[model samples]
Target: MTFSAFLWMTFGIFGTLAIFSFLYKDNPFYKFAEHLVVGVSAGYFVIILWHNGLTPNLFQRLADGDWYFLFLNSSKPWYLIPAILGAMMWTRFSAQYAWLSRWPMAMYIGIATGIAVPLEMANRINKQLFAMMEPIDFANFFGTQGFDLLDPTSGLSQLIVFVGAMCALIYFYFSKAHEGVFGRVATVGIYTLMIGFGASFGYTVMARISLFINRIQAIEAWRATGFDESNPEYHGGFPAVFWVILLGVVAYAIVEIYQHRNRPPQSEEPSA
Candidate 1:
């Protein structure tokens, strides 16, 4: 295959192996592989900034004598604000002017928190709220059985799930005590939440198994043939990146399990 294909093939093989190395234990090899993934991700983000911000808006403008774009917008030249803030971050390196750096840092954090709150709510509320309103059908995942939830078509499942979601949401409401309808509902919600979580955990395990199978496919197909992201020709045509993610998660899981297993057992001494 082509060099690019060869590169992906190499990544799929070793990356998969490096990830699986953690199965034995949380070794340096797995840590190296995991860190490599993170480093690559951070590097990729830098590349994106360079391509989107530097290449066009910064460097191109400087080259073309469009200083207005650098300092600010054509109308306002506000771009200078970000540049100034960026420069201010470096000030923290010194002892004296470190206080000057906090203005930008505070603004950055304040703006991020401002943006994130609304997005978090929309993600949790908008999607899940509707899900709460809708009927529950386990057969949706099975496809062929269609929407027939059960013989009785019990709304208890939906009620339980909805109550659980709502009650769990209420648990986060620190303003007041969970009383009245919320108190009763939230109690039910806790049980429903537990059941939902248990089912989800099972699903997650199955997904990991699927991922392992996919990684095997990627390695075998690409080893002889090639990895084609655009129009990959493989046994199952699975992307190598999926395997990387799966491996990373698995590695993290094993580490977590090992940590739990190795922790000193708690004493059950009688309380005074």
Candidate 2:
């Protein structure tokens, strides 16, 4: 492997192991990895926001006056309103004029809510209502085409979803006392919610396991085939840096254990 690729792989391996060290205990290595990740992410986000967001949307529009070519002759001064509001948000940093920041904050919230309401209604509410309203014919439920009742894409599944949704909504209804039939339906809704939550948790665990497996595979590959000059498959040699980090952590742990064992015990004063 080239020097650059080898260097990057070394860093990646060290970073991965350092993060995994947290499983043992909270140590400097884990803290270093955590801080590095947070710092890198924050820096990268700032760069992306400036280059892809502000540079194109704010600066470019202001400089070129390209307001969708709607106003060819007139300058696009309307864009300045948002820019001013954004600047006003920084007033919160000042001790004397912190209240001025509330105006921009309120405006931002109002604008965001105004934009999100219709989108949420169309994409979430209306579409979900349409999906739940699918016809539940008993004939179709037992037909040759409906072999799998549990299949999510099947029409029968819609009936199951509609029932679950209705039950869940009933569980949230606090207008009247949940007694008799309503209480039973609400109990069914609780079961449905628990099942949903369990499935979600399982899916999340699987996703994390998949990521861990991928990282382990990469580490194994690196160890099996050191960067060989002749063979592309074995590009880099065993990482000495990883060994150094491992040894350093081991030494630190040993020292901590020794110190803990040998430290003087505290003496209590006589009771008052």
Candidate 3:
């Protein structure tokens, strides 16, 4: 068909194969794809910087000779502020001016750390606590309203979940010793937290598996000109695409094994 359609198909086929490269335990093909992704991302960032930061703001502001607007816009751009800060940042290149670099670095660090602590603590504690303590209706669980374990209103699973969440939070309190009453109880909470974390991890892994299955489905849906079984396009079940994936992976694994077999010997150097 058209070149654009062919290009799309080509990329799709190759991307699918690239993901399967994981089975080979990493190789040049996987590395090539990885570098391609990084290169494309860097190119995108350069284009964005040119349009948003450099072109409209710096260049245009300099062209218009507007000092206030120059901080944002420019045409024949002086770009003094960023240029100065950028120059200050490069002061690290000189032994004498290296300490000057610390001012900007400290400012960045102070602002970042200041904002992060409160937000991180609130997200970790308050949100999790309220979520764990939400309302659960019990009438649906046991058929009879009296003794239903599954219904959140019945307070069985919810109690366990709540205890687990609270205990887990307490496990992080380092100011007091865990050997005391609260600390002993907090240890049990640690178990609950581990269970919760494990469940979340399992869910995330399943989501990745679902994405992998979706890619396979996409490849299966691609149609071409193959009316008869004897045609070259028939390719048994899948197309030549499957073999490329299967062999690419096999080749990668073989290379990995060979590399490992040829690894250099470890040294037994003394530590200070």
The C-alpha TM-scores of every prediction are 0.56, 0.81, 0.57
Instruction: Encode model 2's per-residue lDDT on 64-176: one tens digit a residue.
Output: 55557643433566878778888888998999989989999898899899999999999999988987887776666644465887666565776778889999889999997
103-192: candidate 3 lDDT, tens digit per residue: 778877898999999998899978876778676535443434666665554556666677776788788888888887897889898788
For lDDT, the strongest prediction is 2
Candidate 3 residues lying further than 4 Å off, grouped into runs, are: 61-63, 66-79, 93-96, 114-162, 169-187, 221-272
Tell me the lDDT of model 3 at 16.
67
Could you say which candidate leads in TM-score? 2
Which pairs of residues collide in model 1?
A: 71-80, 72-77, 72-78, 72-79, 73-77, 73-78, 164-189
**Candidate 2 residue pairs that clash:** 226-236, 226-237, 227-235, 227-236, 227-237, 228-234, 228-235
Say which prediction, candidate 1 or candidate 3, comes out ahead on TM-score.
3
Backbone clashes in candidate 1 total 7
RMSD of each: 11.4, 4.5, 7.6
Ranked candidates (TM-score, high to low): 2, 3, 1
lDDT on C-alpha atoms for all candidate structures: 0.71, 0.80, 0.70
Please give the distance, in angstroms, between residue 152's alpha carbon in candidate 2 and its true position after superposition.
3.9
Q: Which stretches of candidate 2 lie over 4 Å from their true place?
A: 63-78, 143-146, 153-155, 225-238, 267-272
